[model samples]
Target: MRLVLTGTGASRGMALGRARLEHPSRYLVDERPLEESEVDAEAERLYRAIAIARDELQALREKLHGALAREVAEFIDAHSLMLADRELTSGLFELIRVGRYRASAALKMQRDRLVAVFEAMDDPYLRSRKEDIDHVIGRVQAGLARESSVEERKLAARVGEILVSDTVAPSELVPLAEHGVLGVVLSSGSQVSHSAILARSLHLPMIVAAHQALSHIQDDDLVLIDGERGEIVVHPAAQDLARFRAWQRELAQKGKRLALLRDADTRTLDGTPISLYANAESPADVAQARTLGAAGVGLYRTEFLFLQRKEIPSEDEQFLAYRDLVLGMGGLPVTIRTLDLGADKADASGLVMDDEENPALGVRGVRLTLRHPQILAVQLRAILRASGYGPVRILVPMVSTVEEMTSVRRLLKECARDLRSAGHEIAEHIELGAMIEVPAAAIALGGMIKSLDFVAIGTNDLIQYTLAVDRNNDHLANLYDPLHPAVLKLLAQTIATAQRAKRRVTLCGEMAGDRRYTALLLALGLTDFSMHPGLLLEVRETVNALHREPLRAQATALLRAPTRARIERVVENLKKAVG
Candidate 1:
């Protein structure tokens, strides 16, 4: 019988390949009570294993240099610190020495204790730290058993193979991509998982939290991973296989059609020009933006530089990175969003306070940055210095009031003056923009737009906050709708207000990238869009096929639709008409 398993689609794509279940070998250590004489030898053995694991991690770190993102490398370094923690080694040694426990037994006891403490934590962000502990200890245990780690075997996997595992760490994602992993299925993970972030950034198809994946899946079974719908077909029947193959072919043809529009201007059929930009997370992504013919970077997530690190990055470090991105774009405007760190993107850099029960409504984005003005000032100075290299804009994220936006603007001016006083040549004019993500901001758009040079609507959070749904909550996922009547009204009001004020407005959220919403956004008077680079050509193709006047009419009809079903019907009709 054909088996279909369902899971959450953490990344967006599809893949078909033979299943390669990743099972890490479990070594059952002899737990016999150790004599006093044997304790020293067992301790020595444990230390040796720790040393081997440390060396292995160091080697992987060196091998990954320049091959992956700097954040991935820092994650490896964090693991190294875990290996060197006295709590793991010395604490285990004390257990073996005093309790007369075998080395493996002592290690297991300590690992369990540490994991228990982390599991008892209230914060999910802190609770996830237990995975790091397990990863490090698993390596040491593999070393003690004289076996290669599961990750090593995974790295040896052949190209175009599907890797099914209980979990995939963020650090493993780059290596898996390098090995040309076709798809990934995990028994546990969420959209906020680092695995999801890396998979999306690398354009890999991934499914997570597939409860029955390992138990039901057998090695060598032909598997189909549909990341779009979060379904995995195991040993599919001939008919189903044929259907999937046809779908794959259709996707390929769609890609080819999108490619044909790579050089085409981002203009409607009636010759109304629109601006298209790419939302980049790293300097490496800048090249992809340029390749996709992005006019400029609409959103550069600067918080990534502060994540997965031990301390705040210095001003010089940030300036160098910002300057590199500025120069890499060849004078294309790079809008740097300063330290939108908090909530799901919490950093270990001691700057973020994770005590909030509901981080989404707590100190986050500009709120957190304002609380730590010294940190904001450092970032502002770096952005100011980088502005001297090319066209740069500073965007503040998560602003619910005009006060927040004006405070940041004032700081930017202060930072510029400080730089100039110290003999630095800063740009005379740097554009300042605000991200309209909060519902309050959208409602108060009229008051906020006057104080800002431009605005970008972050529909991801806007939809979530407006609808009172946590997008990452699997149970609430069904309720998180971009086309919901309330969401549409908020978007319409924001776009209309911006147009009335004659302020430049851009949609730089997931909605902008989704081709289905492209025509709808165009009709609502959104002329600028920023999205993932992979979606650039497809969106541009959508733009090319649309006529401004017809789309406007369709959009007006959509806004007047009283129900989601009606709105969806209108959108579908618009897509069919344009095609």
Candidate 2:
């Protein structure tokens, strides 16, 4: 067997390790925000606008065929929904009238608009859903350009388990699952994009943001990719081959068992419940979550509705996305996080920061929103408008103090006032909450939880920033351990504080979905968890079959240990005991 590693595709004929998957797409955009020159020209605007609408129309056609089987009424209803989507339609108009963009320009404009909406979302699963919409919009922006001929696509059939590539796009990535392709390694791509999302989902033994992949080897050469290890070896001898082959076999076993983890509201043997939820970034992901039997979406990143467009999303545009998510949930409550952007999730105006040693700590998430407060007002209005349509929870991230939460509430109240002043009735009631990600905020959980309606632990950033470990960096990946005792203590403490205050708390982090931690977290008093839709059911099943009461006692006993290893052993024993 051979491998196709994605790097910069340089001429050097040799390159090092493969690119590992980065964070879920809910937190980052796939492409760098549209360049200045690309957005400045009117000709580009006109071209982009027409292209986007035309492509959306094409998508509409695909849906219409399916709807026709239902009824003309269903078809009309779908069209009406699309037509009434002010956020999307207005984005189309803005590209043509205000931005004067066409084709790529307009498509980029729509993407920018979606970025803003995603910024307003509170749910990570909701946020991850943006990748799907981005895929649709990107397809629209790109029009119907077939990168590979039918025969070229069939190249996937020729190789027993090799990856294929087309042009500079990560074209080889998409067909891997269907083509009986073993793994994906793209030749060239930005850090954030559809290619990255696909890689994470497939768990490809792949890499991106690398150089010299395409030129280094011919089609038939033997190569091995340690995707889990982020290493790719070209012309490896028998030893390397045996190792990778063994690993591939092991991974295949995991794949077969993964689907067995289905979504459910499960309880342990002692009767403790585990709230397993999906983390999606866009409205489109709601459907995926449902298929996985997800109880609800934990994080709905409402930013994509704003990015890649010429103008901001109107309430109508925002409403369509928000409403679709709420309705799509089949009565499941969708948690919406307001825009947590400034640096990474830039808009038509562009990124607000210069080169920095650490951009993640720089102007991003709640920090960005506080500076550009007016941006908050628009999103508040849109989210509020959508609230009337379904069960929606509003959450704010990176809140360091009571003051920020109070200020955010004031803005949300003002949005209600505006809606009332406009002679529109606001939604009856909405739940407001804060993310306990920062340590300072975690410490203040009692006060914040008392003041706020709920508290959700965003363990992703909490552990990374708390430990000063950039989870995105390959060099530091070993050090970025969620299982580290200090991190575990922090998580346990945060949950305890929330529980003591008698406030509802949930975890929407990478840890919440882990099977290894299920017993520990439940014992620690965390009943609600938000994770990727794919893992929702498995976590649920583990919780369902396990005994909760005994596990809880064991967890309490383990927390008293001084060493990390000792604590882990206790946790392992609890799972085994429950079994």
Candidate 3:
């Protein structure tokens, strides 16, 4: 009998391969008491294990090249720092020498104690650091057990396998990609977790929070991973195999069709041109966007510089990064979002507060920057300096009122003045935009758009806020519907408001990247769409096949649909008409 397991579709793709379950390290070690005479020997064993773990990380670091190196370096460095931290090492030694416990037992106790502190934190990002603790301790335990060659053995034997694990770290994703691993199925994690983000960047399919994965999946079983639907089929039946083969053929054919559209102009059948932009952060992402013929970068994330670090990135460091991004676009305009460093993207750099009871509704994005003007001022200066290189725009996130947008504009001018006073050449005029993620912002965008050059609709947060559903909570997955009537009405209103004001509007959320939502967004008056570079061609193809009048008619019917079921029916009809 075929067993079907479900999870959250963390990354959007598919894979089929043999299952290779990743058994965790011995967290429950032998806790037998140690004699005083054996204490020194056990301590030596631990010391050797730590040394081995460090060397293994160093070896992996040396093997990385290009953008892959930049992506995983910080996570690996954090792990290395943990290994060298006197607090962790000293605590383990104290347990072994004073408490007379075995080497592995001492490590286990220390891991538990530290994990407790992390899990007790209010911030989800900070709380998730417990995974890092477990990973690091797992490595050390592997060293202690003299199973240092386990990874190598697994890699050698299991090429082109899907990894079924409890969790995967950001640092582990690159190696899995390089090793021909088909995809990953995690027993626990969320779609927005760092590992899932990196997997998408790497173009790897991933499923997360599959509770039955570890128990039901076994080695050598043929598995089918439908990442788009978050389903894993174990030992698929003959009909399933036939369907999967047909899907593979269709996907390949579609890929070839999209490839031919690389140089095609993005326009509807009625000859209305649409602007498609890429949301990028790294140089590799920028290169792909350039190759895909993107109009510009609609969203360039800046928070990666501030994460997994002990200090804030200096203005000069930020300037260089933004400058390179500008130059990399080959003169295309780049919209750089200011440090969005709260909520699920909290930083280790002490810049974000850790005491919020509910971070999603608390001090984050624009609120954090407004509270600390110095931080915002420095970032504005860096962005102003980068503007000297090419066309640049500054986007503010999590804005609720015209007052917040007005305040940021005031500070931007102040920073521009300071830069000129210090002998800097900057763009004479820089466009400023606000993100409409808060429901209040979307409803009140009429007053807010008057003070801004443009506005961006972040559908991910807007839907989450309007529907009152936690997108990261697997239990609420069904409730977090992007097609909810409330969400669509908010989007329609926001877009209509921006259109009436004659301000340029862009949708730069996950909804923009998904081909499924392409026509609906067009019908709702989204003239500009931005997404990952890998998704641009497919979306462009969908845009070309659409007719303006039909989409407008569908949009009219969609707005009157009072419930989610009705809204979904309207959307389905729209998709069929286009098909």
Candidate 4:
């Protein structure tokens, strides 16, 4: 029987394949108590399991190469770090050694405790990290059982099948793709989840949050999934198959055409040139950016250096990292965002107090750095030292007031003076910018503009803050729209203000990478966009196909439109007009 199902389209593509139903493989532990004599042996067994789990992740990392390796390594590295976290490992061992619990029972107890902490948090991203706990625990449990894991079995056998599951993990996506899994259909997941992001990067068709998939989809059932539309046809008819085949051909042709534009200039149909930059973190990201012909590095996150560590990164360590980044860009301008850690980002370095009532609203980003001026000083001095290598710009994150920007400028001056006294060469002039993510900062750009050389609108946080919506919450996903009228009004105001002040502004959020918003952003007088390296070419394609003048002409209507529905309609008309 033919049936239709709907879901949130997490990744854009189309897949027609036989459905492979995946039952959730949660490891259920028996609560058998360990005898005093069995405690030591059980502890040893736990240790062996952890070591094996670590080796499995290492083996998976070794199997990947090139872009896939870089893209997937971070997820693997994160899981490995979790396995090593003393808080987790120590608690598990304590349960066995002192509490007289079985190894499996101890694992379950520790997992539950950690998951409770993640779940109590108001921040959706942090809450979603509970999924990581589940994945890591499952891996260790599989090791303890000494059996082929469900993931391993599925990876080995599933070829040309669209996997239907309750949810998928970030680490599973790449390996499954490598194994020729056609696509994925999740009964529950958020589009903003790491798994969704990876699927999009890998160009794998995926429909997340399809609550009916598992109950409705049977193994070997012919399924056609349209990732862009979030529509799944179980046992699709002949017409559905025919339509999918045609769309596949069209997409292939589009891909071939896009490949040709890699070396071409980025300009609109009306001959207006635009800047497309990359938001990068590691050396691999920088290399990918260069390969994709990105104009520069717009947002190079520094938080990764501070994470998964026992102590804060030293100035020398930071200097080397930033210096290598500047040199890697080969003199193209690089914008380095100061440490934006706090909130959902784990502070393993103990630099932050974990007892804040609301970490997101509390000391984070610029606030966290300001509170620890010595940390700020070290980062500034390192950034100043690296400026000597090539063009570098300092972008302060989460700046809510002119005072924060002013204080950073004063400290930056001091750092430069000290670097010169210490006989270090530095850039003659380094640009300073503020990430306008706070609602207060966007509204106060007029006052803050004087202190900033440039500004980057971090729409990910801006939308969250402006709408009072937790973006990572799957339930509130509908409310966390980027195209909300108020968001557009705020975005338009920021862009116009920066343009009038002759300050370069860039949108370096997820919005910048999505092709659907390219025309709208262009209309808002935004000339610079920065996104993941993998997404730049597609956005460049969107940019090249647009007539900026017509889009710009609709700016007034877009902003003045009272409702989201109206704004969307106007945007659609603008696109049609340009077409």
lDDT leader: 4
What is candidate 3's TM-score against the reference? Answer: 0.87
Error of 1 at 396 (Å): 1.6
The global Cα lDDT (0 to 1) of model 2 is: 0.60
lDDT of 1 by residue, 85-158 (tens): 67678888998899888877877888899999877866544566677777777788878877876468676556
Give each model's whole-structure lDDT.
0.82, 0.60, 0.85, 0.87
Ranking by TM-score: 4, 3, 1, 2
Query: Which residue runs of candidate 1 sit more than 4 Å off their true CA positions?
Result: 23-140, 191-193, 307-314, 343-349, 354-362, 421-423, 463-481, 484-486, 554-567
Question: What C-alpha root-mean-square deviation, in Å, does candidate 3 show against the real structure?
Answer: 3.4
TM-score of candidate 4 relative to the true fold: 0.91
Candidates arranged by lDDT, highest first: 4, 3, 1, 2
Q: TM-scores, in order shown?
A: 0.85, 0.65, 0.87, 0.91
lDDT, model 3, position 206: 97
The collision pairs in model 4 are none
Per-residue lDDT of model 2, residues 1-579, tens digit only: 444443521111122232222111122223333444655454444445435544444343344321011122222222223333466656765654555454454556677768766546653323433443454454443332323222243343343444523222233343443444455444444323434433544444455444555556556555555444444566676777577677668657856665666534466666665666777765446677888777788888766665434576676777777778777897888799987654334344343453343456667667777777787777778778777767788989888889888888888888888898998755777778998888889877767766688888998789877877655333344566666777777888888887777777889976786666777887777888888665676577677777767766776667777777787778778776466
Best by TM-score: 4
Q: Write the per-residue lDDT of candidate 4 for residues 1-579, one digit (tens) a residue.
A: 889999999999999888888676556677888888898899999999999999998888777664445446667777887898898899999999999888788888888999999899777656767878888888898898886753685574288889888777777888799889989999887787667877887889999899988888888998999999999999888899889989989989988988998898999988999999998888888999998899999999888788656788899999999999999999899999998987445556778766675666778999999999999999999998999999999999999999999899999998898889999999878889999999999999998899999999999889989998776667777888888988998999999999999999999988999999999999999999999899989998889889999988999999999998998898897786454
